[model samples]
Target chain A: MKFHYPNGKPYVPKANSVAPQLKKYKNQVYSNRGMTLEEDLNETNSYYLERKIAIIHKKPTPVQIVNVDYPKRSAAVIKEAYFKQASTTDYNGIYKGKYIDFEAKETKFSTSFPLKNFHLHQIQHMEDILKHHGICFVILRFSKLEEVYLLEAKHLLAFWARMEEGGRKSITKEEIEELGHHIPLGLQPRIDYIKVIDYLYNLS
Target chain B: MKFHYPNGKPYVPKANSVAPQLKKYKNQVYSNRGMTLEEDLNETNSYYLERKIAIIHKKPTPVQIVNVDYPKRSAAVIKEAYFKQASTTDYNGIYKGKYIDFEAKETKFSTSFPLKNFHLHQIQHMEDILKHHGICFVILRFSKLEEVYLLEAKHLLAFWARMEEGGRKSITKEEIEELGHHIPLGLQPRIDYIKVIDYLYNLS
Candidate 1:
């Protein structure tokens, strides 16, 4: 009779029937799961983990826990805590015997990625990781274009420093096209970033 | 008037006065601010971080937040949450261009270190990391003796497999001493674990 979303939006089955435009409907159903770039990346990481391909994970959201109540022996209820800005990038782990760390953030603005998307400390942390010869990068997602790019940390650092030097507050889309590696869309692993890593590493 | 502890016990400052046994008190003060092995390691990691010697950080305790409230424009308060057993090790970081992941645990028993200190998933996580050609280990601390040792994951895996086969559930102190590297005590960076790492890596 009727198909509905959790939000109670009624679905029209006829429009999505198997026909000439089935490919369009198939693509819609494929990406039907509206996941943010971070969630999709996490799923990609899990795919990597399941096959023993990589051991990367998004660090748990940081919180400053202050008080707790032990209601039972098994459960301790936290009473007071505040979210804390992470001192480093959001995700980090081992990939092909190398340390891989990166931050994933999406921008609705298609023309340029804003500098405000990253914090100063996070940029500093990337610098620190680079000093230790670790791999660092940022995943920039332009939702309008459905494009994701792996932006090298060194390039990001250069652009970030330019902001402090009174340059542009954001990097234009054209600049990102030139400086970053585009991540191909996939089915099992939504964003296969390690392929980009191999490409970037071999280049250096 | 007499110096006293907050517990109302009078402090014996005279016994710690300059004498042949003063060195004992000095050592006590040096290591005896009463920090657990985990805290000492964290401080040591910080010392390394400050000097740009290495970048290591203890992951924050993970919590599952079920309810939160926004009473003000800028503040979000967490009302209910519970601690979750971490899926991986207690620490993971990049050191010397390599991924270092390890768990640190302390036991009061002088004879053996209990296998119960680690969860099955953590052991599996280590195996996964090792498969990726990353370094993984366990730092065992004998709190009573103030002794710490770094045990490689391969050695730990062997003992874990032995236990699954109905072998001893714990590893004896002697076995750990033989297989692991003893962390030397120091005035600064109290637990010099990187030294143990240098020793272990050179062996391989």
Candidate 2:
């Protein structure tokens, strides 16, 4: 099945030949490990939760429910609804007395991550979180290269500012490699983002 | 329009005549102020957000989408879906470099606040947050009395422990008043729960 944003953009497809589809996980490495970045993060959060290490969770996809049916004795069926763009990042929680906030995005493109993947409101949200002293970041997954990196929200804001100043609308692989912390994929927690947080924040 | 939970219990009614309905706010005091606790909190959060005082948000309602219809050149329509029980608290974020988490609930009952207003999973979530050193609590509103209280998660946990040992299923108004900080309602930042937080946590 395919899902789309209310703005008429495709959200996720069961299978996609395109570069930006979130569910483009039918590849060999992804199939061997898990599916999408979302699945990995969910697994990682569950692991963290069970071990009492951290308490992170992906916010549910926001939907604008228009109509619902109260069928007798069964579940209430949402008859008509539209996907609403999230005002904040995808994932957030508490880790070691600090608030954590982040968004996860994956691209099949091997060289660059387009700025179009994020909305303006999300950028504003990250800015607000940073001002409030929350640990804020973005998890960028290059699916084709089988590499993931944790980029602090500040770097993204810088790139956004550059874009606004008539620079390129995407952050290149080299730039990301320089500014972002590489998150090595693991078995138990899958995407060990908190490890990056620990190293960056000197928690360990 | 009326919406029901997946369990077939009424979620929100345009006008509810019975108790326990989340939308039972058609009274004079409520109409003079805001309609519901949710509206007030949302307004308060907005006030905080605008001033960069805190970075808090109410998590979106979770839904299990079973089917979608993607019409050509139009937004994808959720054809079938059901509400899912949230496994975490309703609200969480950062406050003055500390992680903050809480659930807000209002009851028509003037004598006591029902423990069943919360689920066990939410309690577990709060426990996890508190163990991680996050500031966690519950915001309770007594609609008939036009009063609000911020009960720390620790107190609620103790109450839950007593309930598990076959104690009363509800926290009496006296008990809540004794243990919880009263949140005086006002204009702009309506609930002003953060004032109670600053006082309790010595942030003031």
Q: Worst ten-residue run, lDDT, model 1 chain A? A: A13-22
- lDDT (10s digit) by residue, model 2, range B1-204: 122232345444223122332233234214433347877888898889878898889898898776677789999887877888898998988899899999999888999999888877788888888899999999999988999999999999888777766678899999999999998889978999999999999997
Please tell me which predicted candidate would have the highest DockQ against the true structure: 2
Q: Rate the local accuracy (lDDT) of all candidates.
A: 0.78, 0.81
Listed models, DockQ each: 0.25, 0.32
Which residue segments of model 1 deviate by more than 4 Å? A1-35, B1-35
Worst 10 residues of 2 chain B by lDDT: B13-22
- Residue A133 Cα positional deviation in candidate 2, in Å, after optimal superposition: 1.0
Q: Which candidate's lDDT is highest?
A: 2
For model 2 chain A, where is the 10-residue window of minimal lDDT?
A13-22
RMSD of each: 14.3, 11.8
Off by over 4 Å in 2: A1-35, B1-35
